[model samples]
Target: MPELNRRALLIGGAALPTATSLTPASANAPNNDEAFWREIAAEYDVTREIVQLENGNWGATPRPVQADYFEKLARVNRDTSYYSRRGMGRDLMAVRDRLAEALGVPSDEIAFTRNATEAMKTLIGGYNRLTPGDAVLYADLDYDSMQDCMKRMALRERAEVVRIALPEPATKASLIAAYAEAFARYPRLRLVLLTHVSHRTGLALPVREIAALAREKGIDVIVDAAHSWRQLDFSLPDLDCDFVGLNGHKWLAAPLGVGIVHIRKSALSKIDHDLATAPDGPDQIGERVHTGTLNAAAFLTVPAALAFEARIGLDRKSQRLRALRDRWVVRARSIAGVQVLTPDEPGLYGAITAFRIAGKTSMRDNGAIARQLLERHRIFTVARDGVERGACIRVTPNLFNTMAEMDLLAEALTELGV
Candidate 1:
């Protein structure tokens, strides 16, 4: 239950890097070298028996962050009661402050949650503005749980639920047009759930434009940016929405259970505070969600993780992930039957991409391909459904992954018979 001293943390020799010292020279490297990334990969302790290309699920922390997490976990375990009563709250708020600074928002406007699901459940369900007969909308590409939350919100409000399909071969124009048409069709729509990046196909939607469009129609947009925030080079305000749910574990490389809920101060009035109580201030962002007791150690590890990411630099990280995706996708497209699901546009994707053999759109077929990639080629992947057309095998490469690993996946696709 010790109070965290910022000066001490900064000067805590070998424990946390200083503000100016952590930046790696390679952050500006012009070439992607196996040796260069291997040096970075050394910071991870993952198994090399299989090439892990499924990092979209949860980002693994680097060794430095992991060590710090373990140390803090031990400290919390040694004096649970003392830490919980005296020190935990202060440390938690400090983490929230760091998160706010990193996210370009005020600390009071953000709150920590167990994960994106918990945050979205609180936000989508607690939103108090909807009334009977008003419609809420979501797309096929939105996360399944979030879509479910929107449906439940609709049911609770006696409001109609409107679902739409995004355009195939998605382009900026097509994406905008499809949403515009849906808005015209559902004039009573009150809320919309937009995924910044579709987990199913790794398609990065133009969220800023879509949020603007929704605003024009007098609709509030709740952005599901769990997959896009750290994976892509952008900030919360860049999405131009008042409500957003973000995942720290997925892209920020924080511990497994950290996520964030951001509510613009002006928009705070729309979401009702969860578990009304004196401590749960009606206007406080933290009051919007109730997570009984959380892992203090994991929450404390966020600053370390943020430092690691900043040292590497987001622009460098973003460009590298996209390059890795393009590496395999370009080669896969040359195969006779393979179809890359993500668009080839520069800004349309990040580390994740999904693909299927021509006509192999069923869940079973896509699952088989994912299994084959693991069993036959020793390359890890996942089968994803919920896209408008069908299912596909999703591949995501992390910072530790090399081009050789990506080529192996591309080669495996060419050899796998549909």
Candidate 2:
């Protein structure tokens, strides 16, 4: 591992500035749009050994953010006592406030966690009001760990857990109707778990509509927005939910081990304070998750990542990713034995999409396909299970990915008869 020295990087003009100072070149300039995005991609030092198409799992920190992370880590390691006692607390809170502002939410409503999994676990496990016979609902597309947490909550509360498999070739109406049926079937449903975007198939759910329906049915929803927050062109409020779990590393391009938990002001009472910090009171969102000591460097580097994203603008990033996905998906669909898991409708997906070879429903089969893609084509992808229909190869392209790379993948899939 390399340690960064702020003096060297800053003096060399390679260091990125603060969010207030960094501004992207005007998009109005003609014929330079692609050039500008390529400039953004240049900030990363990815290798050519393999083309990475599994960025949905964890987005590697770009050069600028990694520099900041290293600098912060070195600083913390050098002056551990002083920074921990006299400096870290204030800086951490400042990061929180900046992040909250960027998300268009209240600062007090958000708290930092290790990742979306821990944030979600804190939310699901600490929600203590369920009683015997109360029901909770979750879909097959929900993250596996979150579904397990819901099941544990059900067990602890002596409640019934309702699990449904989302319909294939899902449409906006069909997605919403599935939740509606779940609510109707289980009238006692008190809490529902919704994934803003499905990790298995890259299907972006209609969270706002589903949240509203849950509210109408007297159900409080805990949203797993780990994949959607930065990948999509929206904010927390857009989902119309009181609780959400987000990942900074996935699309915000932050260092790993960074995630967020948001609890609305009015909904604070629904979650029980974490046992480790129970005495701190339930009003503060931080009390909901008692993470003792974490990698302070990762959280400290968040501002740089946010500044980079802010410079590019979320909407533009989203559009670029959608175009990349469309580039490959549109071509891949022409091949035989190919099934695109994500719907072809607008606003239902972004860069993430999955594909399957006909009748390949087993994990081993999907894994073999992913291996072949990597070994034969030098294209890296991952196999995802838990989709009711079958396992699929998830393809995620980041900002650094080029259309040529997607063309290579299309060629590979076509060659494989998929």
Candidate 3:
């Protein structure tokens, strides 16, 4: 579609800028806050045909990153040997270092993975300690992939898979108590997986408290920051967890295939997952290099994403997202038979929200509702799975998303009479 428009303009007028017009002179013009984000959004090329509210799944990368990613691919294709031998590994790693610096963690403490799933599997799959009756505790709301991995370990090692429900209208204390209760149920609990921000309902859990409590019980914690990285503000040192994993493309606005893992230096020796060795060699911590070749462009463009964030600032972005979310909540809760499953507590939720109609259908039926919303209203959303609640519609918005989009969603959802 961008190409079609580009061609149309060429036929009658000056062609649309192919991101080449974004010179320093242009970027330096006036106050950058609004213009910066607007420029980034303009690059996304999201069609007017649908309102995308499911960024918890994945977000289309920004134009700068997309262009950079394609450039890296072209570079590789341009000269395979020169790119592979020298230009690929170390040069690309400078970008990784920059990513680590942005996260406030040491570069050596960071490693790239294919996605959050790979990071989770690498961090826990070779945990190196699991006795019979040993346990891995998790909430009912943890992502199905992580839970599935835990259950697989349960089947193979005779380990206990302790599950507990998160308290609704969650508070830091309530979330702490929830994990405590689950820990109390299993005497030999050895690990606890906490989703820093739940994918289904977009609840940003209190990771610091949860990790501190788990530490008291001598349990290892691996925080899934899949949504937390961009959806909420987080600092690694403050959380004090053993490991953290995140998806770069979903919320971070980086090119796809750039995921992150941070293993506390002390804990690296204890973790023995198989990944490619970084050029520095295996004796070093954060020496992880994925075996397969990866693109340097998307990984490099992380700096562009961060620069864009610096322009908008996390606080202002959070304000915009929360305001959008609160608007949806007001519209959703007003409808009869609608029950918000996620907490309405401002701190507990970011840009994500979910609600079910009373006795209308289970959360599993959410996919049906989501499909209907899309087919009928051109609103794109996702239905969550693998929970006691039947199904739930998950909504997330990026910086590009506007209140107008939310209004469209609200009108369409209210029309469902749910």
Separately for all candidates shown, the number of backbone clashes (residues 3 or more apart, or on different chains) is: 0, 0, 6
Q: Write the per-residue lDDT of candidate 2 for residues 1-418, one digit (tens) a residue.
A: 1334321231243432223222345444332265455566667777656778889888978887889999999999999979889989999999999999888999999999999999999889988769899999899999999999999999989999999999899999999999999899988999999998888888999999999999998899999999998899998888889989999989998999999999998999899888887574656888888888888999999999988777677888898889889989999999998889899888799999999999898999999999999888778999999998889899999987777678878999986673
Q: Name the lDDT value of residue 202 in candidate 1.
A: 89
Task: Pick the winner on lDDT between candidates 1 and 2.
Answer: 2
Candidate 1 ranges with C-alpha deviation above 4 Å: 1-28, 276-282
In angstroms, how far off is 120's CA in candidate 2? 0.3
Give per-residue CA lDDT, model 3, range 1-418, as digits (tens): 2223322232234332345234565455443244444454566766656677877767676666677667777877788888779767777688888888878888888888778887887776757678887988778788888988888877778898888778765776787788877777776999889998888778878888878877888888988888888677766886788788888888777778778888878888767646555434655445543536665566767777777666656766677678778777788878777777777665677888876666655655676788898888777888776445546777888766655567767777776663
**Mind giving the per-residue lDDT tens digits that candidate 1 earns over 304-415?**
9998887677888898899888898889888888888789887788998888788988999888888888888778899998888998888899987777677778888888
- Model 3: residues >4 Å from true position, as ranges? 1-40, 273-281, 286-289, 361-364
The lDDT values for all models are 0.84, 0.86, 0.73
lDDT of 3: 0.73
Return the top candidate by lDDT. 2
State the displacement of the C-alpha of residue 190, model 3, in Å, after optimal TM-score superposition. 0.7
lDDT, model 1 = 0.84
Give the 10-residue window scoring lowest on summed lDDT in candidate 2. 1-10
RMSDs, each prediction?
Answer: 7.9, 5.9, 5.0
